[model samples]
Target chain A: MEEILQLVVFGIVIGSIIGLGSMGLTLSYGITKFANFAHGDIMSLAMYIAYFIVVDLGLMGPTVFSLSFGWGMFLAIAVTIILLAIFSIAIDKLIYKKLRRDKSNIVTMAIASLGVGIIIRAVVTMFWGPFARNFVPGIHEAVPITGNILIKPDQIFIIALTIVVTIVMYYLLYHTKLGKAMRATADNPDLAAVSGININNILAYTWAITGALTAVAGIMLGIQAQVYINLGFNLLLPMFAAVILGGIGNPWGALIGGFVVAISSEVSTAWIATGYKPAVPFVILIIMLIVRPRGIFGSNI
Target chain B: MDFLIIENSYLLLTATGVMNWFVGFLTTFAIFAIMALALNIQWGFTGIFNFGVVSFFMVGAYTSALFTIGPPGEYENYIMGFELPILFGWFAAMITSGIVALLIGLPTLRLQRDFLAIATIGIAAILRAVALSTEGFVNRARGMNGIPRILGDVVSGPDYKWVLLAITLTTLVIVYLLVEKITASPWGRVLRSIRENEETTKSVGKDTVNYRMQAFVLGAMIMGLGGAIWAHRMTSIDPEAFNDLFGTFLIWTMVMVGGNGSNKGAVMGAFLCCTFWFGFPLIQESLPDILGNKVFQLREISIGVLIILFLLYKPNGVIPEKPKISRHL
Candidate 1:
């Protein structure tokens, strides 16, 4: 029971991050109608942005509740969102828009996005080199949540933030004009166009939201774990698994799917060697594809 | 004047040697080009979007490595040798990868293209994980080394390379001939029809699934051959050698740039893109410190950029597929 509890806590922390990242990915896939292979790189890029702020700016002054962050990390999150948003939109405007206009096939778009991913990964490696860095140096003691079940403050912070973000996102999605327009655009682009929803603007907004969500997820993962160039790429399959499990373009499903994937992987370490942890989500993804390619919450698309 | 002549002659010899280094010997370009040919069959001839070309390549490499190595008789702590014949190794490579591809394809072939692509990637990831963790056949992370060369170590330098090249060219010709024959047949026509309009092809009573499976497996089989050839040349094997960026994506870019559906285009794309890929490091060595150190990463970025540009502007590739001619009187 203690082991299960610890695993659940750990799973939720990472799962929420995967959920957040998958949401961003699914949104872009929904609106753009193509998988953005660069989504993982975007997460990694966001982590770098935050890393630069905290480390380079020397803003590691005040600790935030003794968690694995400082005032500088908080500030970095805001800046990361802004910068990543612009970067995401620019990517869309440059690569995706050009490809979409050319009436390119889905595979071509996918391969192009993969190319984008490669470019971002290579560029990040060039800048950061291939080393892992953490938001804070020293490891803090794990606080006990229950009998023999201990959790990190940062993990707690991650869960809380995920809840808050989920609520805020739900409200924004349900009660906003922009959200409705976006949903309309995702559902039927032709219909949405006919209904006077500017598809391009909606797409750009989707990219922006995606950018912001990916930044938060990236930064949170960095805080909870370590920030590495391949963080996003490594997480790509899990995120895809989450997105597919939730149903493509289904935001609500993505949140649930993320937990499912994370838990499966975390629990898998018990049965299999830890070295094989990365393969868990992939196995899940294969099963998901065979069982429900349309996904649990997704409509036939 | 004598000094100038000698200098000019030296430069000429050096240039020839450099050229010889790239093309004259057992360049992996032959192997990559053959893999590209395989991809052309799968992606170009039939649109099976596989991003896990390296999985089969790995399968080919390791199978050949294990088969050709000396036999592990009594000692558990052996050099992990198998002592199989070279031809047996090569055949095993193709067959093993083909079987793996068939298994992967059986479930995935019916799914959407994206699902298939994702599944393939997943399979590749799993294979990599297995290679990293399991030591039974793959020898784990340390990797198996000193596997005997296919041709015994009697030949040296260019002669050795030429032998490898001869073997490669022969294999390439065989693969090319087979693919050409397959593509020209009614079965090949059916594959194109399936690629163009699956629904229409289905309506015409063609089993699109079988054709896809055949193409996927055949492509993988050739990839296995490529891997086997590569392993024999390197005389060793390791999992990391099959990293996807170069191992898989490069092949996709090659197929795309060479004209996806055309066999000749596959070879053209393979040569052009691979030359650029291997050529960059040499050029980078002469560059300033700031740039030279990061040339490898830069090369990846450039390849990435090249993929996007080619997809965007030259989707048809350099050598576009020829338009069909009418047989009407």
Candidate 2:
């Protein structure tokens, strides 16, 4: 019973991170109408940015904020988010924008994003070598609750941050003019353009926000495991699985789908071999596609 | 006499080393050409997005290795293996890979384009993870070593690679002719129609799903064939060799550069890209040490830049697919 509780707690913590990762993917797919295969790599790039700041810059104790738990996280996340947003916009302008202008096929765009991902990965490999490094210093200390359940401060932080971010994202997407513009564009780009919704601007904004969210997810993952060039590549499958299972282009669906995938994968590892955990999400995705092709929350493309 | 001596010696060395590298490049190009033509059948003609070509290739390598080497001795983990003849082993590998593809495609083929891509990519990753964990199968991460050499055993060590190279070229020619014939036929026209517009084809009473499955399975077989050839050439196999990101990216780059819908383009792209890939590293190595590493990084950056540039400037590829005209008119 205690072991079950522990696994549940751990699953939720990891599930939150996956949820955050999937949100970025779903949002980008929603507004851009192209699956950004480079989305996972963007997360990896952001984690490296935060790692450089925390370790190389030696800003652990001397940051503007007091070294309190909440303040330290706030600073780290803010810096990471800002840098990621800038990087995403630059990538959009340089690669995706041009591809979009040319009216290239979606497959071509997907391939181009893959090229971008390879370039990013190679650059990271050259700079950091092909080894893993942790962003947060020190091991996670567990906080006990009663005699059966215990949680790490990092895990707690991840859960809290995920809840807060999802709420904010939900609000932003539902109540804002920009959100409406995004949906309008996604539904029908030509129709949205005819109605004077700035499609390019909305897309850029979606990419920027998605980029920032991905950075948060990546940093959390690095803190939990370790930061590496292939970190995003490894996560690419589950992230896509979450998005597809929840319904492509549906952010809320992605949020639900992420937890479903993460928890199911973790729990399955107990029964099946650990190496086959990735197969869990894939199996779910295949089943979902055959049973309900539109996805749990997706509209027809 | 002194000048002639130095010049002749340098030329002789250059001739030997360059000739070997050129031959190696040709072998690699031929293998990739076969794979690209297979992809062309799916993406170019049928408009099916299969991001999991490497999975089928891996299956082919493993199947062939297992069949040729027979089962592991006592305390070994992998499944049944028979010491089949080389020709039979290759045939079995191709069939096994095709069956795997058929199984995967049967259910997933009904999904939308993007969903299909995601599903296939997931399947590829799952296969890699399984290979990594299945210790009894393919010796896990330790990989299979000491497989029997095909033509290499018959030829001298130095000349063995040349023999394998000849085989790959022969296979490439066979694939090229087969693909040309298929694409020129009525079946190829149906694929093209499905690619141009799925709904239009459906409205015209064509079963798009069945065609997609056919293309997908056929492409997997070709990839398997290439993998079998590649495995024998190297005489060793590992899970890592098949799962690298560069493996898929290189094939996609070759297909795009060659011409997505043209077999000739696929061959040309493989030759050109493989040469560039091999030659660029050497060029980087010749520079001063510090500068050389920097140049290597720059080369990677250039690949991304070139992909973007090509999409913008030549979206149809270097040699665009020629539209077929009817002689009856």
Candidate 3:
């Protein structure tokens, strides 16, 4: 039972990260109507940007509350988020926008996104090289929650950040006028345009929002694990699985789906070899595709 | 004797070791061409989206290697090493790949193309993971080595590559002709019809799903064959070699750039892309270490850019599919 509890805690930490990442993907799919295969690469790019600022630039500051990084990391995250948003918008203008103007199909869009992903990965590889890096050098001890159940402060920080982000996301999607327009555009672009919504503006905003989310998720992942080039690419499948499970384009559904997938996969580690952990999400994805492809919450934007 | 003299001058280019380079280049081209042709049959002819081409290739290569390698010695451990002839290994590779395809296709083929693509890629990743993780099964991450080469006894050293090249060309020509023949037949027409418009094909009383399954399975079998050929050429194999970047995406680029639904385009695409792929090393040699180190990254970026540019400008590819004119008309 204690072991299960520990696993559950670990699962929640991972799930929150996945849920945050999936929200970005789901939003991109919602507005763009194609799986932005570059989403994960973009996340990796953000993490590398943060690493460059924190590590390479010598922006050292005192560590806070058992978390690995210092004030520099927080600043890095902020700067990275802004840069990522602009970078994503630039990518849209460069690649996706042209394809969209050509009236390309979803498959074409997906393929283009894949190309964008490859380019991003290659660029990251060029700059950072293939080796892994860390934000802080030392290993931090886990804080005990109960008998044999322990949680890291960083994990707690992640969960807290997720909850806060989720609340903010709710407000943006439900209460704000721009959010309404965004939802309108996602639902039926033709209808949305007929009603005088600037589709281009919505797209830019959507990319920006998703890009920001990707920054947070990527940084969290970096803190939880190690910063590497393949980091984002590796997480791409699981994020897709989470998005599909929660229902594409539904943020809340994605959050729940993220938790479900993470917990299930983490629990399965009890039986299966740890190396096969990556396969678990895919197995779930396959089963979901066969059983309920529309996803649990359905494809509501 | 005159033919031999002419052959050495024309084909060998022995003085500059150009023959060695050319042979290696062509061999890689032939293997990738076979795989690209398989993609052409699936996506080009049948419109069956498969993003996991590498998985089938891996399955085929490993199956053949396992079949022919001698029983595991002390250092290495894996499942089967029947010590069969290389011919049996190749045949077994095709059959195994086909069966794997059938199993994977049955569940996912009935769904959307996205589902099929995702499922295949996911499965490919899983298979690689399995190969890496299963220590007792496939010798873990160390991978198998020293499988007997084809015609190992008869041919030796520099002479052997020529024989291998001849065999590869023969296999390529046979596969090419077979694909061309199949695509021209009435069944091929049904597959094309499904690609163009599945609903219309269904209305015409054809079992679209069954036809798709057949195409998918057949294409996978061809990929398996390509994998087997590649394994024998390399003489050793590892899980790392079977990645999506090379195994799936590159093949997609070749097919798309060559022109979808055209077998000749597939072959031409493979040839050109392989040239671009292999030409990098030559370019790298001219530059400093720091600059040369970035060549791989540059190559991948170029491929990505190439894919996007092609999709935007020439989506149909270099050799666009020609409409078949009825003979009676």
Find the candidate with the highest DockQ and give its number. 1
DockQ of each: 0.78, 0.61, 0.74
What TM-score, to 2 decimal places, does chain A of model 2 have? 0.92
Predictions in order: lDDT: 0.83, 0.78, 0.88
Candidate 1 residue-wise lDDT at B229: 87
Interface RMSD of each: 1.1, 2.0, 1.1
First chain TM-score for all predictions = 0.97, 0.92, 0.97
Q: Write the per-residue lDDT of candidate 2 for residues A89-207, one digit (tens) a residue.
A: 88889877887787776777887887788788778777876789876555656878769688877677788889999888877877999877877776787999999998789888888
What is the full ranking by TM-score, best candidate first? 3, 1, 2
Q: Give lDDT tens digits, candidate 2, residues B1-329.
A: 01111223243357776676667778877888898888888887888888888888889888888888767867556665676777776897899999999999988888777777888888888888888897677778877666666764578767877887888899899999999999888889889888889899999898989988988998899888888877776677878887645456677777778777888888887777776665566665358877566655656666666666777677777877898778787
Model 3 agreement with the true structure over B1-329: per-residue lDDT tens digits: 00111223333345546767787778788989999999999999999989899999999999999999999989888999999999999999999999999999989898787667777878898999999998878887888898888888789988888898888888999999999999999999999999989999999999999999999999999999999998888878889878878899899999989999999999999988888877665566567889776988888999999988999889989988899888899
Could you tally the backbone clashes for each prediction? 5, 2, 0
Error of model 2, residue A122, in angstroms: 1.0
Q: Is the docking of candidate 1 incorrect, acceptable, medium or high quality?
A: medium
Model 1 lDDT per residue over A121-194, tens place: 89888888999987778877898877788888888888888898888778777789998888888888999999
What C-alpha RMSD separates each model from the true structure?
A: 4.3, 4.5, 4.0
Off by over 4 Å in 1: B1-20, B24-26, B72-80, B153-158
| CAPRI class of candidate 3 | medium
* Superposed model 3: Cα runs more than 4 Å off: B1-14, B325-329
Worst lDDT run of 10 residues, candidate 3 chain B, spans B1-10
